[model samples]
Target: MESLNKNQLALLTCVIALSFSETAQASATALSPSSPGTPYSQLSNKVMAISNERIDKQLNQEINKVNDVMATRVLAKIGDFSSY
Candidate 1:
């Protein structure tokens, strides 16, 4: 799971970087250089923010799964002592 998360982070970073690069190149060639607050930059920022939120959700889900597994195994080992 850790490895999977690392791979996902790497892939996401690469994809976003590539997309930003492509957008920058396209803008440079097709129009004036983009300023800091331009629509293109704003769009890129929004994409990054959204991706970050998604990553956080994925990590939280993974954590919950691990917690559930641990709880189940602990209960199995402890057995039912309530009857005593």
Candidate 2:
């Protein structure tokens, strides 16, 4: 396989993702709706199912948890290094 540059890869990925999402949405009324069962649609559907407020709340909580952990580790390291 040929190597693709970062920008080309990113653009290609986005294009493919968009295609699958559009196809899945179009196949919503199909008898099988198999594409919707794929990870792409499952994630899209999950996101669509929830409200924007809930998404923001979850994102904020995740960010807070990450920041808290990082702060705790940094403080611990600084204290340990300073006492040596």
Candidate 3:
């Protein structure tokens, strides 16, 4: 098999490291709810519910980013095979 050049190897390493870091960060963030001491703390229960809803929305966005990356990778493999 042909070896990767330095630039190609570096780019691959960087992409892998970034993916790992993003997965780790999302996992960590998913473990905790938004802190009560922030502006959400000062609001009534109804407003606090809205704030929590927003937090959930943001969490879903992060999760979607991870999913999108995985989907892109799968599609790339499919494209590679179909090109033959």
Candidate 4:
């Protein structure tokens, strides 16, 4: 009976070890960053691309506004060139 108990204990210990190893592996994979080909990475790239495009558009608008102001000032300084 003692030998049988010993065998059962050993088997239980092995099962527990295997389960812990599997759990650790699963958690490690979950915590790791997603590969570039993954959907999550693709989505992030798309979001960044959109954000950059928006920034470019806003910069262009501001540049245009400044140009318009400068042009108006230059025209005012020229005074009635039409008479010349």
Candidate 5:
């Protein structure tokens, strides 16, 4: 095998060091108490709450739309100039 040039050697050393550092960090994180499940549960609850609020908002919007349509139809039927 050909000997590596100085720059290539330096680059290879940096890559290996970074790989080991990443592995060590991953191991450290895995050993911590914060697992994925707890955060997922919290996130799921938040999503559900947001979804419910959006649904309620949509229902209110539909109700208002219907009310406006009915009001316009009533106004069209009563076409006199001054009865207020």
Candidate 6:
């Protein structure tokens, strides 16, 4: 079960990284060379902000799953082992 959880988390990380890269590339290209203070090759701050938000969200989700498993084990220990 722990290995499965690790695999799932790894897969999720890969997917998120892939998608964020694509989005950042697209946004970078969308900005024009002559567009005011913006550089053409520069990535948008919004893209970075969103990517950070996604990473934090994923981390929090994984952390919650781990916490849940710990809580279940703690409960089992506190209660009856015969039931487990």
Clashes of each: 0, 0, 0, 0, 0, 0
The candidate 1 region of ten consecutive residues with least summed lDDT is 27-36
How do the residues 1-84 of candidate 3 rate in per-residue lDDT, one tens digit apiece? 133255445655665565555545554454345654545334445454444555555556655765687699899999999999
Q: lDDT of model 2 at residue 52?
A: 42
Report the lDDT tens digits of candidate 2 across residue range 22-62.
Answer: 54554453424554455666655654554344445554665
Q: Which candidate's lDDT is highest?
A: 6
Residue pairs in steric clash, candidate 4?
none
Regarding TM-score, does 1 or 2 come out ahead?
1
- What's the lDDT for residue 2 in model 5? 40
lDDT value, residue 60 of candidate 6: 71
Off by over 4 Å in 6: 1-37, 40-42, 81-84
RMSD of each: 7.9, 11.5, 11.8, 30.5, 24.9, 4.4
How high is the lDDT of residue 18 in model 2?
59
**TM-score of each model, paired residue for residue:** 0.47, 0.41, 0.39, 0.47, 0.43, 0.51
lDDT of 1: 0.63
Give the alpha-carbon lDDT of every model: 0.63, 0.57, 0.57, 0.59, 0.57, 0.70
Which runs of model 2 end up more than 4 angstroms from their true locations?
Answer: 1-50
lDDT of 6 by residue, 32-63 (tens): 46566865345467666666776677667767
> For residues 1-84, could you state the per-residue lDDT of candidate 5 as single tens digits?
143255445655555555555545554555456665657566556555555555455556655765687688779768654565
Q: Candidate 1 on 3-45: residue-level lDDT in tens?
A: 7578667766765665566556554544455554467766667
Looking at model 6, residue 76 earns an lDDT score of 84
Q: What is the lDDT of residue 69 in candidate 5?
A: 72
- Provide the clash count, candidate 6: 0
